[model samples]
Target: MGMPSHLGLDDFPDDVADEFPSDVKLALFRRARAGAALRLYRRRGWNDHAVRFQYDRAAAELAIALDRWEHRETNPTLF
Candidate 1:
């Protein structure tokens, strides 16, 4: 479903989430520092507006994942 050279930040593999342990997944759920955010996009070879968008989206995903884990832990739901 993707090309080798097109592996951008948003282009992270779908299976990546499935591979990590829940604890490791929770680690990616933290808020990344600004420098880390920039470094992440740069490492992914992003620049310009695309870089900003990818950084914002990645942060949002992390926030959402953290919230999901929080809720799951409190409610003890099957996830």
Candidate 2:
């Protein structure tokens, strides 16, 4: 899928959100927040160290979100 021109913390379809547990939703929220921060730092030409920190944080958050999403079905009681 093509990337959106803009990003927001609450980007998913509202109806779909009800299907997942709170932990999964929270993971996605964190991932989106980190991604937005990373994008902003890069666009504003922030210091390399700051940008890299956001980059790493965003990557970690994304991994966490993906893992939660994938495992949610098998472990519905996960937090």
Candidate 3:
């Protein structure tokens, strides 16, 4: 199998699938943020500072789930 294509967070509302439920989209967003952060940390050679930065940012994004929650709550019918 080939290495997967690079996926951007913007690739989808969450999962690139056309019909994800709001809840599933939010969950996927969190997972993707964390996954991306970890990858960035590794690319930085996992230096303590880089790891901490990536981990913290990812945690904050995942914890609050900023974009998904805000959009879903504020524009419940938009998407």
Candidate 4:
């Protein structure tokens, strides 16, 4: 499926959708899109070191967001 401009909570798995707030979901979606954009930029030969670093950071942030959401969903104490 193609990337969406905005990700709704409904886009998440039912468990996740029920657990995460809208802001967290939006952040996860934005970071994912940013990372994807950076990847495309690098692929197009726009491989400046700064761009690469930003891409890496974005990717890391996206992973962290997902992890955080998962943790919140799985652990009642975290929610």
Candidate 5:
């Protein structure tokens, strides 16, 4: 079996999670911020459309970074 559809930084293989690519770092930062925002939104009882949109955007960014990283690892010559 391969990695799951969703993965946290710790779920990544090896030290790649620690010394990640710049894009991964950015995505992780955004994901963390979005997560924090979600918590704040919930605390304020603002479970609206915007909150969902932010969540989706953050998830997409992280997924993209992971895909890119996986591709780079598999086909190093192409990168």
Candidate 6:
């Protein structure tokens, strides 16, 4: 599936994109899209808040991936 034009790969910071693998980058983008969707749903007063859970989970996953990339970048010998 293609990302929305506003959320395309070019939107990512160069440093972050260069450090992350393709899969990780895609995951981050997906998480961002989920967060945006969650915001829209909340703004429109949709009753179901279950999407917030999904958005939270995606945020957590993205955070973990970013942490791993940062750690690896700083500790090259450990890998």
Each candidate's TM vs. the true structure? 0.44, 0.53, 0.38, 0.49, 0.75, 0.65
Give me the overall lDDT of model 1: 0.54
The stretch of ten residues in a row with the least summed lDDT in candidate 3 is: 1-10
Candidate 4 global TM-score: 0.49
Give the winner by lDDT: 4 or 5: 5
Q: Weakest 10 consecutive residues, lDDT, candidate 1?
A: 1-10
lDDT of 5 at 18: 60
Give the clashing pairs for model 1. Answer: none
Q: For each candidate, what is the lDDT?
A: 0.54, 0.59, 0.52, 0.59, 0.75, 0.67
Tens digits of per-residue lDDT, candidate 6, 1-79, equal 2222323356555564665566567767878888888989988989647888888787777766666766666789843
> How many angstroms is residue 26 displaced in model 6 relative to the true structure, after the best TM-score fit?
2.0
Off by over 4 Å in 5: 1-5, 10-16
**lDDT-superior candidate, 5 or 6:** 5
Q: Write the per-residue lDDT of candidate 1 for residues 1-79, one digit (tens) a residue.
A: 3221111235677675665437436445432444376777678887747556665766666666556655665799575
Question: Which ranges in model 2 have alpha carbons more than 4 Å from their true place?
Answer: 1-12, 48-72, 75-79
lDDT of 5 by residue, 1-79 (tens): 2443444656557655566778888887888788788889888898656876897799898898889988988888943
User: Candidate 1 — which residues are off by over 4 angstroms?
Assistant: 1-47
Best-to-worst ranking by lDDT: 5, 6, 4, 2, 1, 3
Best by lDDT: 5
> Least accurate stretch of 10 residues (summed lDDT) in model 4?
1-10
Q: Rank candidates, TM-score, best first.
A: 5, 6, 2, 4, 1, 3
Off by over 4 Å in 6: 1-19
The residue-by-residue lDDT of candidate 4 on 3-70, one tens digit each, is 22233344545565445566556666666667677778878888657766765666566566666756
Off by over 4 Å in 4: 1-44
What's model 1's TM-score? 0.44
Clashing pairs in 2: none
Q: Which ten residues in a row have the lowest lDDT in candidate 6?
A: 1-10
